[model samples]
Target: MQTTCACHPLTMENRASAAIIVRLTGEYRVPHDLILTILTVMLGATALVAICHRLGLSSIVGYLATGLLLGPYLLGILHESETIHWLAELGVVLLMFTIGLEFSLPRLLASRQLVLGLGGAQVATVTLLFGAALAVAFGIDWSLAIILGGAFAMSSTAVSLKQLGEQNELATTHGRVSTAILLFQDLAAVPFLVLLPLLGEQAGGIGHVLLFTLMKAAVVFVLLAWTGRSLLPRVLHWVAESHSLELFMLTVLAMALTAASVSMLAGLSATLGAFMAGMMLGETHFRHQIEADIRPFRDLMLGIFFISIGMQLDPAVLYQQLIPILLVIISLTLIKGLVMWLLIRGFGYQKSIAARSAIVLAQGGEFGLLLVSQVISIRSDEAGLLQPVLAGLIISMLLAPLLLRNNETLANFLMHSGDKDDAKNAIDNGAQGDDDFRDHVVILGYGRLGRGIARVLIENNIETLAIDSDPRLVRELRLQGEPVLFGDASNPGLLQQARIDQARAAAITFDDFEHARRVIAQIRRFNEQLPVMLSHPADHDDCEIGDDNVIVFDSEMESALMFARQLLVVAGVETSAADLAVNSVRSHDYSELRGVGDED
Candidate 1:
């Protein structure tokens, strides 16, 4: 006891015991509680998405906010796992590939002048102007300024296309112009990929690095083009013949990944390689099928990528830099919109078209994030300054959907004083009067089957007016010199707009039986004598509607039986056997055939 008096009353043992108790208490907390937190965050996001959809705002903003709330910066429900990042990267690749698949040679050729000329000039001029300004104002070097300017030159193709499609304006003069600009931006990303490595320090000189990069990119492009044209078609055909969906999906994924890897090894961006592969595949007959297969994966991955972007928000930094970020956003949107509008209008488009195009492209693109990341990776010294810029770009993208949704109302209000005639012109441009053609067939639904009929009818020199629910399809057909009206086929207003009273015959080309039935009912009520023809779905039971005035074409069953009979005949089967093959397919699917007389 006398010896203990010399020692301190509190020992390390007591302190250690207290610390262990606290740690244990924290560790033993209910792990299952996290599931509830995650569900709450997801539920909140779903509600937000629904609200935004109702308001015509971009659902992407809702998704991003959902991610931020659940992210470590906020509620901390979603941890930044390595698994998520890898999957997000794959999503970016697939997204670019899907874009390539949609990019057809004929479409590109149709818009080549705009894409290569106006689009090219817009990028070069804006990049040079903005780059120089940033270099002068911010005291940044030319290299960093150049990178920033290039990033700003790009608009989010995904956001623009989606919004345009929603508005049913993608086939308008403005939509086409916006598309061309986006296409140019995508192609320009290739050069930035080559330039990124040059920004890094290497064993070689700058000139040597540049030369080597150019050579490598050229070689890779040539190899991919050759392989895609010469070998990929054969491989796809073989895979298709297997009739295995899983195998087909696997083959596509493998091809995309392989191409990406090859491009990376050749000193180019993996995204660029994936895009090139998609472009090559677009030339093949299986493009549509491949697109359908890859779509689900691409959409999932893209959502993950957006979530990753949301996770990058640092609360402390965001709070501190809020004012500057807002300023940057305002300046970027205004300047970009003004420049694009002026440029597009100068290219002979109407003022309304030009304004819409500008609004759609005002937001910064996802590629800007990639460019900023590349810059930070190469030059760590500039990371501090670029952080706010990156944050501002993301914020702009977040606000873009909302702005675009209200763009029409906003543009009309703002430009009313300056150009009153523009609004009238836009309306006039959109209108399709019935007096324009005689003896023309009016087609309801511009889907695959509708399109097939339109093609054959057009080939036979019969004028056709196509009515579709999809605004995008209507706009596209109108742009191509066809009369197309966007409205519900069953609506009397739409029928009148399509000149159903004066039309010789109306073809209900929709695949959905319910929708076809509605349209047929509507048509019969409008004109009892008008001939109504419908294309039946594959699994449809042959049933008639009205009297001889109504006709139902079982295209699906007819095609199937025709093919089966032909196969039997080629196999040296007797006439009886061929008839049996045809009858078998028809009996199972088309036995209840009756015409409009059965439509009580």
Candidate 2:
């Protein structure tokens, strides 16, 4: 395959001159090295994720591991490609997008106590405590100490949320507390992002610069919010009316890229813009479909971001700075965990919930890496220490899932040793009444299609626990006393939370191909005998990897068949003849479903 790729393939000129020929034609768009790097990363990451899945590890670890192996310190397959660097930026944007999709004003208001009360305390207390320690211990400049301290105050939103989600603990009081804290950190990080660069700007008065930036950000945000309220839906409606999945996807990409560009031009991070775009659109009914379409892109880009982060870990440096790295890791986990726990306890949470949330949020988050890198860029003298600090951060994140997996045991060992665990206040992190939900159908993606399927099941007196990520939908349904929960249905953690073990069947109506694959894979793991109704979108190609493997409901094909069947009857053909004709077409399509294209 490689030889074919390198040989005289798909070009008028010989392989030796094909690249040159393309360059001569003023179409030297992408470099061959960039192409090779992308292919290498994809293949390596996929294989590693497959292995990790079998070993019950998160795919985030797999992507990071792939980066470490291919990094400059290892095989050197990916040599810090600039293209990959920028693409990694897109990963951050997508992360913000996912967060925005799940964030809504009502939910924010609902968690106001935690966000404003506990969240505000965690940041303020952690920052002051850590910053003071740094200043006193190392005699670093007070300003830089505060900067690094605030940066370190951040907990990993991606890691913590995913960890909580995987353990089926995300719906618990502790999980909500953790999520609320993370959300505050996300908001806090925005100010830090604006402040980081300004700290390096020695010319202007620092306070004045900060004020100016804040004012500009406010104006830009208000403009975008107002525009989104009036303009975005109309654009989406027009594109949606086209009935072309491709166009709909293109429209989404355009919106994200355009908003990101405008934000960058307006002096804010593209990621902040992306998040704003998502939050603005999140309130609309189109959110589920938007999330489904954006999910695949988001996942791939997020993987790439993790890989880029992994690439930053230099093994040689890690070996040389092992002692300091260990010290940093231990301090970060212990201090941050203690601070978080105390804050939660002060807020009237149970000891169990507080301790567990502390452990979960103790690690250095993905955003910390961003801050570390940013500070180092603004202060080159700190470069040497930042590298090892980053290495420690990565290690902590990789260990997060394992820590969360055994959190209950860990929490028990920490407190109330000789007592029978209090079932009332003790958060049920796993196996919460699965036996009670037996024989119920699990509907992934509680959107239009999933809801319709659920309504039908309900009509027949079947129970359903609809899992979704849209905050608005989840909030409304729960208030109306419906059995729906907000979570990423593709995640096994969410599935377990929905009590997959007791589920009799499932309807995978998610419109995104990637998420659908995840949902199907997770279902097969829990119960191979359980029936799955997967949705094949209007955009299935023969060469797509998952198409042949899973039996899915093809909406486009079924709709076409329905239209044709009724048309035949209207044209005077017998009902049975039309039915036979439709069945024959269906059979023929099914036979070729797994087949390669004619040329292949």
Off by over 4 Å in 2: 1-36, 139-143, 416-418, 427-600
TM-score of 1: 0.68
Error of 2 at 51 (Å): 3.8
lDDT of each: 0.75, 0.76
**lDDT digits (tens) for residues 148-226 of candidate 2:** 7886788888777777766767767777788879988887776666666576655447678778878878887898898
Work out the TM-score per prediction. Answer: 0.68, 0.72
lDDT of 1 at 533: 83
Structural RMSD, model 2? 10.3
